[model samples]
Target: MFCHSMTNSMGEIMKKDKLVFKSVLLTSASFAGYNIGSGFATGVEALQFFAAWGGKFAFSGIFLALLTSMAVLIAIYVIGFEQRFVKSSDVYHYFCGKYFGIVLDYYIYVSMIFVTFTMMSGAGATISQHSGLPAFAGASIMGILCFVTAHLGLERLRKALSYLCICTVLFVLFCGGYAFLTSGVSPIAGSANSEHYVSMGLMLRANTFGIQNPYLSGLSSAGLLIVSGFAWASATGSLCNSKREAVFSGIFSSLFFYMTTAVVVYLVLTSMDHVAGTEVPMLAVVHFLLPKLSVIYSIIIILAIYSTISGRLFLIAKRYDRGNKAMGFVIILSITILAIVGASLISFSKISNVVFSIMGAVGIIVCIIVLTRFIIAETMPKQLL
Candidate 1:
C-alpha cells in the first residue's frame, strides 16, 4: 500500500510538470506568432531596422531591442496574471488608468486594423511574387481565412497559432543555417559588393520616423512590437496556470523572437547585394541559395501572415464581442472587407515602411509609460502602515 501511494504521488507530480511545460510552450509560441507577421517573416522588417545598420551596429542594435522588448514582455505577462479574468481592453486601463487607457485602447484598435491590412497586403505580395497570381486574389483568400479562424475565438486561435509559429521558426532556422553554411561568404563580405548597397545614413534619412541613431531604431523596434503585441500578450497571460508559467513563457518567447530575427538579419546580410532591392528579402535569399524551396517558403510566409492576421482580427472582434456571437461575426467580416480593399490600393513595401514606422513611434511612447509604471510599482514602499 505504501509503495502504491508513493508511485501514485510521483505520477501526479510528473503529470503536473508536463502540464506546466505545455502551457509555457503554448504561451511562448502564441506570443512569437503574433509578432512574426508579414514584415518579420519576409525579412523586410529586419532589413530596414537591423541589417541596414550592418557591422557591429546591426548586432548591437538587435541586442538592445531585444533587451528592452523582453523587459516589457515580462511586465505584460505579469499584468496578465493579475488581470487574467478581465477583458482584453482592461489591460490598457490597468497600465494607463481609465482616461488614458481609453485613448490607448482605441488607438490599439486602429493599429490592429492597420496591421491586418498590412498583413493582407503582404500575403498578396508574397503570392504574386512567387506564382504570378493576382494580388487581390491572395489578399481576399487570406482575409476570408482570417475571419474564420478568429471567429472561433481564443482557444482555437491559440492552438492554431502555436503550431504555425513553431513551423515558421523551424523553417526560418533551417533555411538560414543552410544558406549561410553553403554560401562560404561572411555576412560582412556582402557589404563589400556595394552595387546596390544603401548606406545606413541614407536608409535612416529615408525613414519616416527620422530616427538617425541605431539605438533609437532598436527602441522603436521594441516599441512597435510591444504596442502591436499588447492585446495578445494579455490574453496569453490570462491563460497561464501560474506566475512561473507566465514569466517563463515571456522570457522564452522573447528569446525565440530575437534568435529568429538575428538569423534572418544574418541571412540578409550574407546576400545584401542581391536582396537589397527586392520586395521580399527572405524569399530572395531562398531563391538565391535554394531555388527549389521557394514555393515552400512562400507557403510558410502566408501561414505566418495568417497567424498574425487571425490574432489581430480576434482582438478586434473580442473588443466588441461581449458574448454577442452575431455581432462578433459582423465586426470581423466588415474589417476583413475593409482590409482587403485597403491592401489593394497600396504597395506592400510602402505600407510596411510608412505604417509600421508611424506605429513604432506610438509604440515607443506606450513602452515608456508601461516601464515607468512597472518601475514605480517595484520601487515604492510596500505599505505606509
Candidate 2:
C-alpha cells in the first residue's frame, strides 16, 4: 500500500522513495555538496560562525545539521504534494498564487534565478582564491554550464548532478586528512584566545579575532547554520513528499553535513594561524598545508559551485514551464541581472548569506502554508468531518 501510494510502479516509486541507503548517502552529500560552496568548503563560514568560537562551536554546527534534517522532511512532504496536487514539479505556483497566481509565482521564480546567479558568482570567486583563475572567467564558465543543464529538464539532471556533492565530500576529506597528518595542530581546538578570555567589564567588550564570548557566539552560529538549512530544505521541498520521507532524509543529510563540516573546520583551525582574519580561511590552510593539493581541490571547488548553479537553473526552468511566460521571463532575466550584481559586489561569504536569507524568508512562509494545507486536507471528512 505504501509503495502504491508512492508511485504507479515500483521503478517510479524507487526513483521517488527515499533512495537506498547508499544512494541516500550520495543524495544527501549532493544536497550538502551544492549547499556548501567556496565559503563553506574553505572554512570561511565555519570560521565566522563555528571555528571562530573554537571547539565549542563544533557541537553547535552538529545541532544545526539536525535542524536541517527537519527542513528536509518538510521538503520531501512538499515533493509528494507536487506529485499529487499538480501532477507536476511546479510546487511554487501552488502556494504563491492568489487568483492569477502569477504574482507569487513571479516572486518565487525570480528568487530562484537570483539564487542561481549568486551561486555561480560564488563559484567564480572560489576558483579565483583557490586556483588563481580569473574570477569572471570562472563564473562565466560555470554559469554557461548551468545554463546548458537548465535547458535540459530537471528529471534527467537530478541524479547526474547529485554526484558533484559526493565528490565534494571525498575531496575535502582527502585533502583535510593529508593536512592533518603533516601540518599538526595549532591553537583553535580548545585554546583560549586571550582577547576572548580577558574581555571582562568592558563597555562593548574587548575585541577578538575569533569568538568574543564562546557560549553566545556558538548559539549565534548555530542559528545561522539552521537558518541556512531551513532555507535550502524549504526551497527544495517540492522535490520530496511524505512527512516520514522528509524527516528521514533530513536526518540522513544533516548527519553528513555536520560530520564533514567538523573535519574540514578542524583541519583549517589546526594548520593555519590568523586564518580568522583572512578572506579565504580554508584556502589559507590549503595553501599552507599542501600547495599542490590546493590546486586539485580548487578544481573540485569549481565543480561544487557548478553543481549548485545547475540545480538552481534546472529548478527555475522546471517551474517556468508550468507558469505564465511573462512572469517566467521576468524571473529568468531578474536572476541573470542579480547574478551579475552579485558577481561585481559580492564574495563567497556574503553571497552565501544572501542565498540563505532569501531561502529563509521564502521557506518559512511556504512551510507554514503547506503544512497547514496538508493538515486541513487530511482532517476534512466526507461532510466536513
The candidate scoring highest on lDDT is: 1
- The C-alpha lDDT values of all candidates are 0.83, 0.55
RMSD of each: 2.6, 7.1
Q: Summarize candidate 1's per-residue lDDT along 150-180 as a digit string, tens digits.
A: 8767888888888998999999999877976
Query: Which parts of model 2 have CA positions greater than 4 angstroms off?
Result: 1-19, 71-75, 78-111, 131-134, 186-247, 272-274, 321-334, 351-385
Count steric clashes of candidate 1: 0
lDDT accuracy of residue 272 in candidate 2: 38
Q: Candidate 2, residues 1-385: lDDT per residue as tens digits?
A: 9877656676776665545454445445556764665546656555654565455454564465346444534444444434454423344344434543455456555655655656666666767776577767667776666655555544444465567777778877887678667665654542245235323311111112223444433334333333333334444444553455455556666666667777776775565344544455666677777777777776776776666666665556555556565665555555655675567566655665455444444444444555555565557883772
TM-score of predicted structure 1: 0.92
Tell me the TM-score of each prediction against the true structure.
0.92, 0.69
Indicate the worst ten consecutive residues by lDDT in candidate 2: 201-210
lDDT score of residue 13 within candidate 1 = 92
